[model samples]
Target: MPRGGIGRHGLRPPPRRFRCVTAGRDYRDVARTQWWRAAAGAWLLGMTLEYIRYRIAEPDRAEFEAACARAAVPLASAPQCRAYELSHCEEEPGSYILRIDWTSTEDHLKGFRASDAFHAFVAEVRPYVRDIEEMRHYAPTRVAGAGAGAAEDTAPNLYEWAGGAEAWERLTEAFYREVHRDDLLEPLFRHMDAHHPHYVALWLAEVFGGPEHYTEERGGFQRMADRHLGKGITEQQRRRWISLLMDAADEVGLPADPEFRSAFTGYIEWGTRLAVANSRPGAGAAGWAPVPKWGWGVAPPRRS
Candidate 1:
């Protein structure tokens, strides 16, 4: 029999009412589950952290460390706080990184904003930083090298791959403590520490040269040299800082594999420019600006 809305087969049209009811149930279930999942996620957003990196001027490390220790303890034990630490960089002397982890972002905000002790600490340590360029906030996404259910490292490597990022953080902290002590680089940079001139020198030398590949090292080194053009940073200080970095890299098990070394060589070469540049500002960043001509003494080395 021929139907009004069907072909010769005479099948009935699909039931709109039945389809609507099924879809509505499914949509409601999905919406409800999504809402619950979001709520659960917010509850589990427990680990909030801030990584504050700085370069304190020379001669102020002891004073700054003591002030921070005195003022930081009260804020450290806040109900919302899980951990707090202050660390220096070994590879790059005079640089510091402070890591603070909170139970929740809300708790962290409350602790800093509401507490007088935290403010006191900030006031005490504020003068020490030449610049606090970056403060990054992070939440843990995954824990590497652990079993499906496990949160711990089963077999840690020198770099602590088994432990993951946590291990890296610990390695950096430990590396600094070993190298940047009274024994080395301290006597050399003492007067220049916390000085704006030194700050700008580093900004140009290490920070700028890494990726920019300044055609002449002068651009970067001049900053450091100009600051201490008269006082002078001895060649020994430069060499010591490099050695400290190398030792720290070794301790952290940063692979000295050929590939890594090749890359690092580039970094060192560029860094050398900054060092040389600042040593002689009269010429340029590299104190003695190399005037480009076709083969002055010997042919210039080819750029990689």
Candidate 2:
């Protein structure tokens, strides 16, 4: 009987009649084979799968296989092609299957297939065009793997962990409430507006990875630095600012994890120091820059 052909009973004939092309062994046909069906059902829930099945003549088998490897290079580099593999059938030496996992059918069909790399891939395999017996895309009904249930690749940034804009609002409100009563810091903010806390929250939110509201709605870093020019901020005032903010962070439940607190306090120290320096008379204005993005135990590098 021909390989992979059905028997008189409507079942795949015994594998003994067929030779494994790659391994050069007799094939062993199994009953009720449902591997591909199960795989299709289990692995296609949220992803698209492209299946390409083809055959190569005896004399062209090796060259065709090499061409397939070369052809896959372009697909492998495409962001839409999440994963791919090529395998030769054990029971049919000339038979090959190419499986590519794509982010979406549109991503593969529209994005990758239209790209220059697709042309390159086609060129590599053009010689074996007649060997392609079947080629199509399939969507899996289910997917299971180590990373199948994983969340997004990016973790929440510092702003998210710090309870977002609302948390910063609470922190600023609490801190400024005390600032109004304090002998040392009150003088600097005596004329503060009723919405001072809101502005500060916007500034903090931008620095902590939340939004660009400070830059868009307000004047951003240059304006912030300009605020303190000629105020002659003292070291004692800087230290008090840090102390009060840390106290406010604690009172407002702003993520007391060691890593978080360390980053939070580090920024407070650095920012207050800069505030003090900028507050001095004759200090040059720092150029405009994006608000720093703080992370767990790290700060965005300062621009040159």
Candidate 3:
């Protein structure tokens, strides 16, 4: 008389299919039907996958592969380059593909190319430049992967999931309000401007994949970093600042889902730590760094 077919010793019985009388089908049948529907939907709204195809000559394939291995060093080190994979085609002997997963197209075009790493990367691959058949990025129209369930998430970027620029403005406004009340954090921002919250919103918006208004209107990352150059923020203050902001995120009705919160909190942790480092006296960190474009569960790699 074990409940739900559980054995006396606590061993579970085999899964039994219960029939749905209304639909005249078993539970497994319904599950399989739902799963296929989900798979189809996911295939319609695909992930962003970038591809770089190369067609090397038969004799030069070895040299090309060696060059690619060397070039990967600098590209792999780039903050924007998330995944760099070079593969040789099995059917076509000399055909190879160099695939890169970038945070975004702008991160590759504007950020990486502007860095010295690009110069080094280019030098290594220069010999086989002529052999490259196609070099382009692609955004998938549809994709399916493991754990894709009935609810096909279209995968909104952090900014969109956080409700875009207006949402960030609300978050920062509420956060600053809390900061003003917090005894530990208030002293650091004693002279903080009324517009500080709005500026912060723009920065968050840019970082979370909204728009580049912060960089276009303001001085971008350099200006933001320079502001913290000598504030001497303490560990206690940094922790309090992060805590207050997270509280504000909850208060303002931001997404409470694990994926969103993880990304959101991850950025706050990184940004606050950097703030603390930059606030220390005589820190020589780069002021002209590219504003990071954060995604679902990924933050940009810290530059050296």
Candidate 4:
């Protein structure tokens, strides 16, 4: 036990988060979990983090980013530099953080700073040096984890994700081929035009975030509803339609990732159900409705 109670009632020491020696172990008694602190500095990779924080006026933000982009190139090519990121604060737009990973502080100070890469890097960044609020090296906490990759990798919408218009055409064509052989669905489509597959492809493409050709060239929603108006699509036929489409998806090599498939299956089920209701004797809800733009239904594709 140390000396005083409230002013000295700590177990280990200050950084170890013990009570202020005299306070005894108050409500903040976290001394038992101090093991992590001791283990933290025993780094795994021995990497050093160099953080450079900057505060630039809003007008100069773009140019600052561009300058850092150029500077980052040399840093990336530097033998002692491992990785780096330059991020703008979303909440504080004029503030930016630049984090760099170096093999070691000594390598960054003694090796990288002495290299040609450093000269090139300094040339691009020198103008902003005065704006730097903090430029210091820190040991990695190891508790830090990576985030969702670089921001440049944007997510594609469902249309671009499905390999675009050509992929949808192949899918519909293959689907109709299966439909022609499926006894459950053949009677309904026995007279389906030779161009039916192509037109259906257009509709699907439009639904899944593609062009508006279906609405523009084809007569959009009403025309689509008109086709199934009197056929009285049965539940069995609707289910079989979905089955064949999925099979066609596999056969035509459509994306099989769970997210894409979930979104695909979602639209298929909703559309087929709507078709069934409209095909009934007097259903008219879909007659005047706009063509629905389908989205990544339940689970959108994972993107960085």
Best model per lDDT: 4
TM-score of each: 0.33, 0.48, 0.54, 0.49
Q: Higher lDDT: candidate 2 or 3?
A: 3
lDDT of 4 by residue, 1-304 (tens): 1111011011111221222111112222322222111221123225676778899998887788778778878888998986565655556778777767687999999999999999999999899999999998776331332123311124566778999999999999999998999889999989989999999999988877678788889987778877788788888888888888999999999999998898788778877886787789876545343456555533557755
Q: Model 1, 1-304: lDDT tens per residue? A: 1111111111122212111111113233322222222221121224666777777766866666666666566656566665555656556545766666567677677766587756765776677655686787665432211123321113222222213344334444544455447476666555544333323322322321122223234353234335544435466666766676567657766545554444444444545554554556364323322111010011112224
Q: Write the per-residue lDDT of candidate 2 for residues 1-304, one digit (tens) a residue.
A: 2222221111122233332222222223221122111221122123566777788889987777677678778867888876555657667778876666677899888998899988988998899888888888775321222223222224565688788888999999999988988899999999888888998899888876677898888887778878889889999988888888888888988987776787678767777887888888889887644455444443322222
Cα deviation at 215, candidate 4, in Å, is: 0.3
lDDT of each: 0.43, 0.66, 0.66, 0.68
Q: Give candidate 3's whole-model lDDT.
A: 0.66
User: Tens digits of per-residue lDDT for model 3 on 216-262?
Assistant: 88987778888898789999999999889989999999988777888
Model 1 worst lDDT run, 10 consecutive residues: 290-299
* RMSD of each candidate relative to the true structure: 28.6, 18.7, 17.8, 23.7
| Residue pairs with backbone overlap in model 2 | 42-142, 43-142, 44-140, 44-141, 45-140, 45-142
- Candidate 1 deviant stretches above 4 angstroms: 1-45, 143-304
In candidate 3, which residue ranges exceed 4 Å CA deviation? 1-84, 88-154, 298-304
* Comparing 2 and 4 on lDDT, the stronger one: 4
- TM-score of model number 2: 0.48
Query: Distance from true position, residue 195, model 4, in Å?
Result: 0.4
Maximum-TM-score candidate: 3
